[model samples]
Target: MKTIRLFSVLLFALSLSSALSQAAKPATVSVNRIGDGPIITPELDQRMGGNIQGPSLIKVPKWIENPIGQYYLYFADHRGEYIRMAYA
Candidate 1:
């Protein structure tokens, strides 16, 4: 009986926490249009250079402190040898 009562309280607490949680939505967005500069520039770094491929980017959330600009670009070498970053 005591075990069941504790389980019910825990279940109720979990449900209430889920109900209070909300999905995050960004307040501002920066879109790269079709004619905008190439997302991957081959000459970003000549030493570790290979044709820059598979670009991934993340826009900073307002609540987070980003020392860089509004968005960040991240990419890795094909063999996972190196991961590089850029800010914009």
Candidate 2:
């Protein structure tokens, strides 16, 4: 009886810890730089997502440009559609 009680307590504690760990996991998010520059930050990266509606901006690394240094700002919806605004 004592052994069974100890096992139950241990199991309960383990389950609780597991639940807490799962809850502690960080949420994932998509990020993009708004305005007229490149976004370079982990927080921004996490915040980026599809369906982004904003102005024309340039993404970093320089090679992704078409000699004009401009890219449309947009986000992908859950359906993976690119919703972007044109540069004016």
Candidate 3:
């Protein structure tokens, strides 16, 4: 019936829109000042993670454009901790 056909089309469109909505990632990131001095210190290293035994310094560029959320910061310490901090 025409009603069933229209309902099927509506459902398809709704499903497509829902998928697209879920696919979009938000563009949000945390930032730290480049020369603010010790965003993370040896004392605070434990908060960041184990093995982050030094002063934190920002080594990333001030401006980064990641619309798709493909980019990540990874660490603020010398150690390979799973941290993320952008510099601005």
Q: Pick the candidate with the highest lDDT.
A: 1
Query: Which residue pairs in candidate 2 collide?
Result: 30-47, 30-48, 30-49, 31-48, 50-75, 50-76, 51-75, 51-76, 52-75
- Which lDDT values do the candidates have, in the order given? 0.77, 0.54, 0.58
Per-residue lDDT of 1-88 in model 3, one digit per residue for the tens? 9999999999999999999988968889897566867444446445665455433444444465553343333344446555555343
| Tens-digit per-residue lDDT, 12-45, candidate 2 | 9999999988796678978865698533222454
Q: Clash number for model 2? A: 9
RMSD of each: 5.6, 12.1, 12.4
- Pick out the ten consecutive residues of candidate 1 with the lowest summed lDDT: 44-53
Q: How many residue pairs collide in each prediction?
A: 0, 9, 0
| Model 1 deviation from the true structure expressed as Cα RMSD, one decimal place | 5.6
lDDT of 1 by residue, 6-74 (tens): 999999999988877864666895665787587676676675567565788787878886467898888
**Better candidate by TM-score, 2 or 3:** 3
Candidate 3: residue 35 Cα off by (Å): 26
